[model samples]
Target chain A: MRGGSWRQSSLTGIGVLFGVTLAGLLLLPFFALAISTPASDLLEGATHPLFASALLLSLRTTLTSLSITVVLGTPLAWWLASSSSKTARVIEVLVGLPIVIPPAVVGVALLQTFGREGLLGPALGSVGIALPFTEISVVLAQIVVSAPFFVKAGASAFREVRPDMLIVARTLGASPPVAFFRVALPIALPGLLVGASLAWARALGEFGATLLFAGNMPGRTQTMPLAIFYALESDVRLAIVFSLVLAAVGMLLLVALRFLPALRNFMRGGNA
Target chain B: MTSWQVIVRARRGELDLDVTFEGDEQPIALVGPNGSGKTSVLRAIAGVLDLRDARITVGDTVLEDTSAGVRVPIEERRIGYVPQGFGLFPHLTVLENVEFGLSTGKNPLQSEERSRRALQMLSELNCASLSERSVKHLSGGEKQRIALARSLVLEPAFLLLDEPLAALDATLRRTLRQFLAERLRLFQGPSITVTHDVRDVAALGAQIVALENGRIVQQGPLSLIQQSPATEFLAEFVGAD
Candidate 1:
């Protein structure tokens, strides 16, 4: 165990070399982006007429989806964490099923459910509310694909909270609702935030589902990822620039998660 | 009038705790080894966990009744609990923690009155200086005092303390025990304290209830139990110096 030949593991050395090489390979895309494109080119692409509209649409839909996710997912995650009923377990598994399934399959599933000839289509058509290819469909696709990220993360966060603490809060004259809002929510909020951020990022990057279910319509359903794809066919420079911007946004999400109180406490060790 | 009668028959496969007791104005000391169901009894009394067969009455109120389908919720039960090591709310300051009970009460006080009463309780506990300090920053002794102040501020029907001194070292435990004993004596209602230390019973002057293997092997005054042990386990447990 000391500084000796026996302590120097050949297996560990080989494992470390493989890990570094893989890590460097993963970083190659980012390196290529920096190597080929100047920063000013990304600015030029940002000024493109299609870029502004697509970015706007992406921001609007992602924001709406994130709001919807937090509102619905908070209670959903809480119920899942605390409830021991068989139905709750079933619902938890169903909600998590989306995360494991491919986004394109999710696209087809949504299409089969909401398309004009699909499951709820006749009823929805009778009401004259078409979902497919509409902006609302874009938001729906994001929600289907992204809300699970928040719910799963939030449920895990809620589980991390000590049941004893909640019981103690109740003994201190806090009603179940009051204790939930005051004690449990505050304690689990950081995890919830992380979950929300993950959902938002997922919603922003959503591609196959949006393309299949919502369709790429300029100034309506086209998000940043869609914009990048469209630009790739018409203009390669703008495509690369759009990609750089998307990568920056993803990095921004990571930085934002680090600043949250929950993650900060986690990084500093289990003092909380 | 605050006397309570508790009859619990709880069986979780192998773990069984069938206990029956009645007391008024006396601090009941729950004594046993690690797996003796002492914590379970406290949880049952606090109304957080209901036994399979239980009828617990405090004063005139029936907190739990298996046959009658009557079970008061934990908040409405009005029982105070100081958990093992006193898990104080790390988010709130001393005064805020004390005020939390009042803030969430059925009929909460005006903001000024809540703060006034919180500070008053802190003064009584000689911890007014810690009213602004966060619970996370306090030492073990300070946290214990603040926890007591938090529970007492609620004016609960009775206090259920789970190993209050178990987290402290010997010297600190000795000091805090004397403080707790004096404070409990001055309090108006009954209390229950779980402990493994025989000296704790001797110091607190509480009636002893010895539990082993999820059953009450002995229950009486410490002097009585010391003279006549109910079983071999109680003999060694209670009669020890």
Candidate 2:
């Protein structure tokens, strides 16, 4: 027993050592990014035209993609959460494919589907529509890659809502949609918000797909990550500043995710 | 008093349940071991579970009749169901949870009217103090009462309770069972209650319908079932020789 206790203590010690090492490795870059530059450099970067256009474009495209993801992914997530069928399982796998597929491959696939000589080429040409090297393509790429995160998280969130609650809601005279809006949605709100935040973060940092599908235009389709890439070729300091700004935004989202539960409780009349 | 009849022929996974029972005013206690499909029976009656073949009627109103091609949607069933552990809406306050039904359905009341009715129902269930409180902060017994109020406010033709006191501690279970008995009396509607404890059956003064392997093995007054229990589960339940 004494030897076992000593072994257990050593195991715990080793676990903590490895955990701290990994955390340090992950956090050191961010800490360096903050302390390496004076605040004035960050301010200068924020005021730059490249920073302004990239920030605005990133915000616009990511918001649009996130909205579309929520609108389309929610029902699909709910269906997946409630269903126990083979088809739902297959579709869930299909939805998850983009998350693991390389972003450049996704860009190529998008090009093939919506490009000038692609599958929908003639149909789109008839309507006088072209999608390559556009802001809309950037939004499309973000949606394809980021929506799966929301759907995966959203489905699990909706599943956490007990089926019995919906049944009771129905018995209480709430229609199917009413029950969904009143009970399921509110119960799953915090989780859905977390998922949306993750998807938005992914969309904000999207690079390879945006680079291929939406060319590196200065103000039109150039998002923040693309701007950072372009800036890095000639101006490393500017790239660092852009990285710092993106890191700050991402950190804000992370902090918001941490407080979502408290916010939900507050909105529900401070019940918690 | 509405006379309620339930005929459930449902197969879910391995459980092939076929049960038929009827009651009026008196609360029917469905005592069965775990995995006996008692809750499934209640769900079938409540129109939440689709049955292979079933007929549920309260008085002359047919809630479901598969052969007749008449199956009412869950919201239109008007069979108040308080599922096991009392499935309260966690996002709503007690009053809002109770007011949910009143805010919807074919005849939705005004907001003031909804609150009034919800408060009245809460008062009837002796839970008026908890109206503004969040359902998340409610104790088990309080949740049971609030759930009852939420369902009873609608005044459905029948009430189906699935182990209404199953989630409470033993000491609280006794008190809540007594409370539930009184509430059932006041309700005066044909109701079915699923339970595992014989004490719950006696406390509620409910007629017993003992189930085994998803089928009704024996059913009668508790006194009668005690005299001649069919299955070993029923024998153990009634403490029969």
Candidate 3:
């Protein structure tokens, strides 16, 4: 009995040790950041004009990127879900490639493809269109880098939809478009929203690609992350403030997403 | 009076289905074993399944005739189908699911009127208490009732149910079979039910069309199919003792 108790105690000790180490690795940096930065200084730095502009720019660009992602991604996702052709698989793999590629490389590749001297550059230049180092370029960069997230989530959600539901709708006198919008879209909304939120967060925090493609310009193209980088070069307090604000917004979005009835149903393991 | 005759031919992998049937006053039950093309027959009649050579006519309407190169879209077929799983829209409330077909159709009923109609349908199915409840919250039996109400509220020319009680427990299946028989009797239109359960044929009091290997082996009154059972497969299907 004593030996069994000793072994049990040792097992308990091992469990606690593993749990603590895992928790520390996962949470230590966040705790350190919270501890290191004083709330008062963070607030003061956040109110600075340049930081304010960056925050606004980040919100605007990320929202625009999100809108574009939803519009284009939803149909593509739906198509991918319904089609079993080899071409659809190829397109799915192509869309997923962005997620695995390093963000910095994605940035460089975007520049090489859409830059002034790149492919389609001559045609675009002839039309007097310039993409690099502009605010629009920032939006474009965010879209290209963030859209795959929305597409992937939206496709999975669409795939989860029962084909019989759509067939029932059609037999009940619903046109294809009406059935898709009324039945499929509502069912897939939670996943689509989650995808949008993820893409928005990624776009909001975008630094490497934005810097490479859009070029950090204050009040023009400088997003919150870019501002944080610039502020850290001069004022550390402002960087902390920007980081806090971004974190707060992200948290708020997550809370809002959780409140959606569709998402809530999904979380509770209810099928759509 | 809406009357229909349908002939469909299709090859799904190794299974080739070539079948023909007609309907008038009687409610038909396509009784068959698994993969015997019962659901495919209903799907073809509903215009949900694409067939290489198919001809379908409902009253004066020529819905589909591949030989004549005419095929009606599913939305235009004016047929109601309840798939095997009941396929309730989990995101919508019971009332909303019933109202869906009416709201999106060519000649859409007004929302208020549609709600009233839906409520009446729920009442018919003894599920009026579940109107405001989300479909996801409904029990399996309640969901099936709502799916039936949703399909029936449209008052289509014909109705199709694929394995209507296949998802229910034995007790629920018996209860629902009785309820469905009563409802089908009052429908005032041709109806087709696909099921493997011989008990459903008796309970629903439907004409039995037994199928084996995608071909109609025998079809007549339920008693005839049960008593004679043209093929050995039909005898096995009827669970001959």
Candidate 4:
């Protein structure tokens, strides 16, 4: 069992070669981004007003969208996880539609719902509120595009919590809400954290929806992705810096997701 | 002694459960083959499982009556349940799990009272040393004791235990069976225990309620059931002709 025949070993060697090739090809650009850029160019781009504004806007919008998603999605996830109704199944599919649909399509849908002269045009106008081409629109676009990740992950996580646990909690004199908060939520927190990080990353890189719905306005709705789009046409080095920054944030989230389970186990003094 | 009457009609998956039984202060042992709806009956009495129709009454108080549209919520039912596999809260310390019911019911105790009561319950179970440990770290028997203590701390009017010793090894199961039998003897209120072991019924000296495919085939003392086992499962359980 320790060693295979020569032919079997050669087959495994070939499989390894194929896997390494694909991985190297996928990672080549990141290495290029890190090594090919000049230090002076990176520093200059980092200090630029456009870079700073775009970075700030991306952070602010993604955080806002992430918080909103968690607040709204937790209860929805719990309900969907607990209910065995056909309506819940339908709603689950509808909630997950945004993840599969293109971001540009999502932008169009948001415009149709919130834009002036759209479906809710008169209602919004009566209230003196216009959502299109605003910072709020940027947040809306991010939420529309990113919320599905959180909801999907959260529902699955809540499902993993044993139904018997909730029943016992309720029978132990905790109300339904108390059972969820004390029993289900803590058990599902790790998965929810991963979902939130993914949602934040998706919101941070929102380009199509923000561009079409919020418009690429400097110091307002021009997020890092949009900045990169414009930066690419004028200065490639500036675009590389923006790409590096976005990639770095994404890498950090991936790294966190990788270690989160181990961290949770350590916090729990290792699983029994 | 106050009498408890439980009548439940519910359908879950393939099980069409419609059973009725009444008992005084003595514990009732609910035994059946796999998938015979014993756990569902306990869940129904506890008001955790929604029933098509039910009339659950303990002495003078009605816990559930579908015809009257009076169904007490699970938290207000004053029923303690120990589900199969113990169902301990994985995130809380053992003491915190015990304190949960006392700290957040209809009439919550103050912080000090809650801690004292939880500690007292743990000590009574001989698990005071496990107070600060996470529930995830306890052994199967320890988890069972902590789970029982957690429920008992609420001072429930009724208790429902579902296969409390099913997860333990044979030796541990035997030990906990004796421990549980003693505890049940001391408990003052009506309780139902779901089990497959005939030894459990004989040890607890409980009224027997044998279910088969969601229907109660026998309900009486174990001696009567021993005279004529109703189903093949029960015959195998009691090893009788």
Give the residue spans of candidate 2 off by over 4 A: A1-20, A38-44
True contacts kept of each: 0.57, 0.89, 0.82, 0.80
Model 4 per-residue lDDT tens digits across residues A35-129: 98889999998888789889998888889998999999899998888899999999999998888999998888889899997899679989999
Model 2 Cα interface RMS deviation (Å):
1.1
Tens-digit lDDT string for candidate 3 (B1-241): 6688988898866679999888785789898778888888888888877798999888888989999999999998888899988999877888989998888766899989999999999998999988888787687788889989998998888889888888888889888889888888889788999887777788777888877788998998877866888988788878642
Residue pairs with backbone overlap in model 4: none
Residue A182, candidate 2: C-alpha displacement in angstroms? 0.4
DockQ of 3: 0.61
Instruction: Report, for candidate 4, the interface RMSD.
Output: 1.9
lDDT leaderboard ranking: 4, 2, 1, 3
Model 2: how far residue A181 lies from native, Å: 0.4
Order the candidates by DockQ, highest first.
2, 4, 3, 1
- TM-score for all predictions? 0.88, 0.93, 0.93, 0.93
Better of 1 and 3 by lDDT: 1
Query: What TM-score does structure 4 among the candidates reach?
Result: 0.93
lDDT per residue for candidate 1 within B45-130, as digits (tens), equals: 88877579999999999999999999989999888899987868776778888898888867988889999999999999999988
Estimate, for each residue in A2-62, the C-alpha lDDT of model 3 and write its tens digit. 9999999999999999999999998786676667788788777967899878978888898
Q: What value does the lDDT take at residue B41 in candidate 4?
A: 93
lDDT, model 3, position B181: 88
**lDDT string, candidate 4, B61-175, tens digits:** 8999999999999888888899999899888889889998887776889999999999999999999998989898799999999999999888788999999989999999889
